[model samples]
Target: MNDNFLNSANAPYVAELFYKYSQEPNSVDSSWRNFFNSLNEDDLSVLGDFGGPEWKKRPSNIIDEISFDKTIRPAPHINIESFKSSTLDSIRALRLIRAYRVNGHLIANLDPLNISKKDYHLELDYKSYGLNDNDLNKEIFIDGSLGLEKAPLKEIIKILKETYSSSIGVEFLHIQSPEQKQWVQERIEEVRNKTIFTPEGKKAIYHRLVESELFEQYLDKKFLGTKRYGIEGGESMIPGIEQIVKQACIAGVENIFIGTAHRGRLTLLSTVLGMPYKSILSKFQGYLNDPNEVLGSGDVKYHLGVSSDREFEGKKIHISLVPNPSHLEAVDPVVMGKVRAKQTQL
Candidate 1:
């Protein structure tokens, strides 16, 4: 009747003996058989409290809560040993999952050049959760945390790595809104934060990259000595901005105001804002001799703002890039002002 007999140290051995006694009474010693036969439903229910507070709160009849494989679940009654083992595994596995969600970004491969070494955190390791290689193959009940109800520790770890520690690391736990945080977690974990593009989509991205590179190359060749502040290495932003425009249009957004410094401004103006290449070339060639001929208050070529309408899949959206001076990030408030003015007009 003493609950201390079923402590963590000997619970597995006792459960094993009880299972053997249930299968064939002669398989275990007489004392073990007698002990097993003396156990009632109440004693069996006590096994639910084996793990931690989470397990302690589980219903006394844990047989319905946990799904056991045929090999582990005995004929007439549940195998208490298997249940205890799985419960402990589930607790450790849950802790591992939470650790990755919180600290997995510490070791993400975010640096494209790989110049800086990543500081790996101990919590991201399986050993930190008291798990070993032997437990990796064991299945644990996760209650659909990562779109899976029950998964092996190895599979869970694989999904966690793919979702949290890949090239794109997400840190959304700091979000104050519970709904927004859960939404972001579910959205990324469901697809492992991978976006699969179709053949046409791939081709479109390739085309954008080619356009961006060609524009930069043309500027470099045309005005050899001029300081253009070109977007040489960061050409991907052209396609990224295009995709943002398309997605925004799809989401009922009709206007987008942008602000950026000299870097990549010409490329964005020509490619994303639909500014004519001839116009940009004319300005670079010093064709604007008179002050009145220059656009946007007679500013330099890159400091000039442009407005254009772009259509994606029949949905039209107007984009406006606010001009900025030599000071970095000076146009942010101007862009916000334009957005506020547009909102007022709407």
Candidate 2:
């Protein structure tokens, strides 16, 4: 709590102590609260001050800020003949009506995955299963006289499906007059093809329906659980991280610094840093355990940073991820500052 203890040498120790004691109600150590509460207004403002690299790129003042338009302006819709008997303005109004009817549209309207092999079925393979491509043939249209989204296409399909489902194992609905319901349902049955997916989709669909692909299939292979938090939704994004990185690197940045936490580090380390999987595993299993190792003490195995250079648009772009405090999102502006500094350097 003293000046000597607040030095760089003791900062890390204090950080850990603050983190640990914070878990207990009475253990928050009063000196920390006293230190924070004692900061002057000037000290506080300096601590929070931020922004301005390309600040010239921002608005000049509060009045210059762009805001969403909240005002509603509506013109009257008058019939042409009814509007015509008055003045020249009325004739103009008639012209407006004629033009509006011709173009304004008194509209009744409605509007409307690659898994890789790890036993991944190519989307092409699911052609026979009616589940995944079933709606492809239908013309999706709707009524809007009552307003928009009167009934979504999916709900309409659901209504039609339930109207006559003795087959495909869809449960039947209970109605007051079954025969009357059956008559309306019979017409729906003629148009609705239950085949939504292709044959391959149907196969995967059935496999899922029957629960055929269980944990036991890999039983012989001896599975250890997967860490599924990220490669995100290429874990089916297709050509994968290379495509993602290539897309992200297009902005005119000389060096890119990213700091995401436990999320994508392993994949990035392997793909970006060329980190050996063996080394990653060693860290995960604590095979590299040495209490005296000081740099990244008490952090998750995947929470370390890496550096590399990539060729973006024929320019060599350097990339590094900063080692962060336990605060994940708090490092975002820090990354921005570093990116701006790199730009200035260029």
Q: Which candidate number would show the highest TM-score if scored against the true structure? A: 1
Q: Which portions of model 1 show Cα errors greater than 4 Å? A: 1-76, 117-119, 289-292, 295-298
- How does model 2 score by TM-score? 0.32
Error of 2 at 130 (Å): 36
On the 0 to 100 scale, the lDDT of residue 213 in model 2 is 26
lDDT of 1 by residue, 230-330 (tens): 99888899999999999999888999999887989999999899998888888888786457765655467778778999998888999988777878676
Model 1 clash pairs are none
Candidate 2 local lDDT, 26-88, one digit each (tens):
344354434334544432322221111121121234322323122211113433222121111
Residue 165, candidate 1: C-alpha displacement in angstroms: 0.5
How many steric clashes between backbone atoms does each model show?
A: 0, 24
The most accurate candidate by lDDT is 1
